[model samples]
Target: MTLQAGTDTALAATDHGAASSNDYRTGTAARLAGLPVETLRVWERRYNISETARSARGQRLYSDAQVRRLSLIKQLVDEGHAVGSLARLEDEQLRTLLPAATPAAPAPARPVKVALIGDALVRRLAGGGRELFALDIVGACASLEAAGRLRTSGAEVLLIELAELSDAALAPIAALRAQLGAAAVVLYRFGASATLARLRADGCIVAHGPADLSQLVLLCESARPGAPQFADAASIALAPPRFDDASLAALASMPSDLICECPRHLAELLMMLNSFERYSGECANRTPADAVVHRDLGVAAGQARMLLEAALERLARAEGLALPVADGAA
Candidate 1:
């Protein structure tokens, strides 16, 4: 993400012979604009959202103004505006259409108590604690050992900074969540599609960057003790759909003997169902325009998983194979 900010005309002058502010390559522009490179290209070709210039070798470059315009478009799109309607507007006109930026709301009377779990996160909070005044920092820890102490530190939220999206990184977070019981767990990490999906599946509210303070605050504010865990609708929309009847039928049709031999397979299916239920609940909390598609998909997955689990359990019993007692069973 280039930090340079100026109109295209000014940038053009700089390109010619003046002091040069860094111009962004297409990839960098995409990051700054919060759009995929392909989406950016489509907007340009279909909507002419921004005009691009080519370098000597034909690499596309975006001026800061163009990146800003793309960012505005993305913000509006997320807010439920149609791209076709917004595409033709000039930058200044689009700005007028956007809701005015408001100051962050004052911290709630009883702010969510947060526990910090990374050196970088600790430093970041220390530097800009004001932006997160809505959260009360009850404890700070750099390692799992220190994080363990948070259980008794009166912290109601665990905010962990993760370096990657791998299972290894997630394992400790899972442990923390389990240990803390009702405490809400939030993860901060920069990840690709796969990682983000996994994080969401695990019921973690994820922020892609440290600078996403507002998003982080919203997640914290939404956290409630003993509340059902759920995936964000945006995250669910990005996940591959899992409720196809054919797929569920194939899974159910597996030989009873084979399924019984690996009883953990049934257990894993139950876990998947539990995860999807949380996602379904989360989808329900979102606005209809944002949540409808994902909410319907989540409900479908939950229904399919539930039926499949029942069918498998019947098959196990019919095969005279005793399944392990399920959690919450008397």
Candidate 2:
């Protein structure tokens, strides 16, 4: 697909070659001729004076050829030749009449900002494509969060990296899902185990591997049908409901901040749930009311604790992480 200006495509196009600063003059003869820059533009528009060159930053610059052309046009205007008359001039006549002016070399293209992220894996995926937004390792999560926030604020998908998700970063994922809603898959890279599992849980079918992504880029470019869409596993077609609405609400409302602030607690919780699931096949869904009371939620815990823990488990299940021990998992 043809990339739009101000998009990553435009940025990449401008960065292809470097140009020297002295190649073109900015506001040179326009200042010397006591003419506003707009006047020069008017002559180009009205009289077809000269072809303009653009700078890396997208500024319009006048080449010496253009300056000489402008000078000729200005003199003609001073001598009372209306622009309408100038347009009808023969190319040979114009060339003969206008003095030779050395053309300035065009400026270098601008650098692209695709905002890529990940290990060698992400760069390989890019495959020499310009204007990638790059980030690596933990930075991938940070980029995802930033992209998620920007997408929520109506920003277009300029950069995306999906190699950074961990079992620990579910809340941010949830937030991104909630914001992107239907359009989320257009810019996302579904290449990790956690990402794949989450997509599966959501009932979304995402293509696997880097080759899949390269194919996707080609498909988009070709305007072909069958572009991949991530399935929402939460839908009825996927794993049916393990927890009801009230249970999910409770989980979302819990103090999940502890996941970020207290990594030690998170580690202990993950370990406990892993062991519990291994032995009992019970998924952990909630935080117990008292850390001291390790009750089998399905058969024992207080009703209040059961409800709370169930919610947390639902959130975890959606993200493909091990569920916490709660009434539902047990």
Candidate 3:
């Protein structure tokens, strides 16, 4: 077997094989399906989420149908559905099982100031899309270049629609946003992954487009900043699992000289916190709109983990129990 670039790429040659535009290799499928490659492989081996077609060399390939199924499964999983329960579901069955769409958020105390761009989008909103969010429309334009008159709007948010995106167009977009002295919510139907990731990293709000009216409203609301302290995700390097499941079980069950089983209780708490922290991190990657919320959860979990680990260490020492290698997180 040959290996290069990364494990997934090495498994698929550039020859394209019998793959059509709708067929995707492991990495693309994982990204589109919002799953890690390894996790997808495991699901294939265990749940066989659905039958997948492999390339000539035996490398797995996911058809467009399979990718869609995985995306649905991912959404359901995030909503608390167990993977095992969903794995056996057919695509249409999964769709029917999905809950009703997320309701629009309640309007804020004071409507946010926003400017609209794009004639069709503006017209659509004019017809009623603007009602989805608590927003004050200060200006309207049909294109980015035509947005010059908007400089006087004193808008806090700029909602622009892009039929397509190009890297060269980014600089002008950035400069225009700077001139308006406002944050932006960019809606696009298509763009290069790297370009989109770059835009996101620079604090610009982005969403798939042409978004439905409610989605547009959500994007506009996202431009509004949250509390100052939580503006960015807190930086905390969480250590790997401190103890395996078996180790934890053993620690919890072993007879202790202590008056109460405080250590056992603490161990349980630590396990819960650790699981939640990792889940938050996964959600951050899978859900673009709620990335901030997940990041916040991950940080809070890390803090809790460190404190609990310290308590666990002290109690373990008091009982003269051998502990795992120090993670130094406490």
The model with the greatest TM-score is 3
Model 2 lDDT, full chain set: 0.39
Query: What lDDT tens digits, residue by residue, belong to model 2 across residues 1-330?
Result: 232222222112232211232223334445434456577667667766555677767755655455455555555556566766765665345545443563222322212112222233333542433212111011122244344423222211122335434544455545555554421232333445655556435433244334454453432222212334333322412122344434444443455544353323333444444444333324442333222123333222223334434554555665555433346643
- Candidate 1 structure quality by residue, lDDT tens digits, 1-330: 111111111112112111113345555566557777789778878877766777765666777676677787788888788999998888777777767683222221334566667666665565543335355555566655456545333556777776655656667677777876534544645567666656566666666656466676667766646444555544533333333333333444445546244444655575677677677667643334335557766666766666666766686687775544423442
Candidate 1 overall lDDT versus native: 0.58
Off by over 4 Å in 2: 1-53, 56-142, 145-170, 177-182, 185-197, 200-207, 211-216, 219-330
Candidate 3 weakest ten by summed lDDT = 3-12
Please report how far candidate 3 places residue 330 from its true position, in Å.
10
Model 1 misplacement above 4 A: 1-109, 144-146, 149-151, 182-185, 226-293, 296-330
On TM-score, the stronger of 1 and 3 is 3
Taking the tens digit of each residue's C-alpha lDDT, what string does model 3 give over 1-330? 222211111111332221444556565566557777688878778888878887777777777677777888887887788899899877777777677884222221334567777666665665543233245565676676666545434567878788887787688678878888788888888899877876776678878888886676667777865513443555656566566545666677777777888888887787788788878888635345457767888888877887888788888787888765433422
Q: Estimate each model's TM-score.
A: 0.36, 0.25, 0.43
Candidates, ranked, TM-score: 3, 1, 2
